[model samples]
Target: MNLHLHGDAIPEGLSRRARSFVASHGVRADATPLEPYRERWLALGVPGEVIDRAVAYQERWGGLVLPPAPVYECGPRYLYADVPEPSHGGGWWFVGGEPRASVAFSFMIGPNGEFGLWGDTWAPLHASVEGWVESLALTHHASQWAKQVTRLHGDEVEGLSLDDFEPVEEVQGIVDTWWRGSDSLVALHNGEAECFSGRVRRVALVYSGLDKWGLHGQ
Candidate 1:
């Protein structure tokens, strides 16, 4: 997927010159080193050998230059436009509007395009929301706060159906655990409609990065 960074100017405090160049060139936000190779191989149903080639290319060539600081706009739009932190391998995030429904992030593509993805959702780590939260090690007090939010939103709402609601609950459980007694923040929308902005914040909390886990082929 191609990533698109939209704003009048790239932020001033970007860390890497490379990322600045990327933004200048209009690189898609979700585009990553392995994308081209992955697309090619997936179309052909080839073996994993090509992924290795892609990784090598990234190691030798791929780098990001990021704008400094988180950029915010009116209408509840947020752009994670800081220079890609080496701590997070410079993965960028572009979250648009309230009630968010479209989002993507970078992924690791093995040689020949074997890839690992990190985003709002994933399949393999399919734990219920409660289970997921418990896994993240919340403070004892925070768990209490989280419980209130969870209880309010969990299975209580009417006509609530989400493909990842269960998993999100797991995430919420974790966030609640960590956030309790910290004056962290909580906002809930009444009625059956999910308070999607809150959900988006929950997802962003754990987004250390998309392409950091040796996707470039360690």
Candidate 2:
């Protein structure tokens, strides 16, 4: 995944609010040091590159604060929820997420620089934090588009495409993934309603939360 970095290596394609948050609060080199957190990550056996990338992100965005509401409250605090070692084992380090969601999912990274969605199950996602950032941008765009499409079509949001919205090169992969897989776009509609009913019940992409992937409804 190619992450577009703006000045100071801040990944582009983040929501406007997210970008602004970074602009205002992201720590610079001269800001508060993050060595303590780095030490903690190191103690947890997180890889050096991953730790560097994460710390660089903290310095750039002032520590992983996500958008408000449904979005998970992630940051250094959540990333380090477990110290020494993650409770889940498998050399996975707990990252962050909302545990109360219908499908509880959390972010995790393996010692080999593999990042993934970890719940009661695990789903590999990106190869690195950088890739994860790119995926996050795509997920954010897809979720927003899904919301708008749902509003516009009401009960008929199936087969929605980015063409319906402004063209975004970055989201092309997500769109492709959605179109190619039945499990990609999971919707909640009245079971009684006709399948493919044009009614816009509720539409959600697999990677909506940046933590949850595929179906959690089981």
- The digit string of per-residue lDDT tens for model 1 on 1-218 reads 44444353333323232233435543333324554555565455443544444444343223322222111111111111111111133322111112112334322221212122234331112122122112222212233233232323333432333323223232233212212122232222221121232243322121111232211111
Residues 131-164, candidate 2, lDDT per residue (tens digit)?
A: 4443344444446533232222233445545442
Q: Give the poorly placed runs of model 2, Cα more than 4 Å off.
A: 1-6, 9-34, 37-62, 68-103, 139-218
TM-score of each: 0.18, 0.40
Q: Residue 112's C-alpha lDDT in candidate 1? A: 19
- Candidate 1 wrong stretches, greater than 4 Å: 1-20, 23-48, 59-61, 68-120, 123-198, 201-218
Total colliding residue pairs, candidate 2 = 8
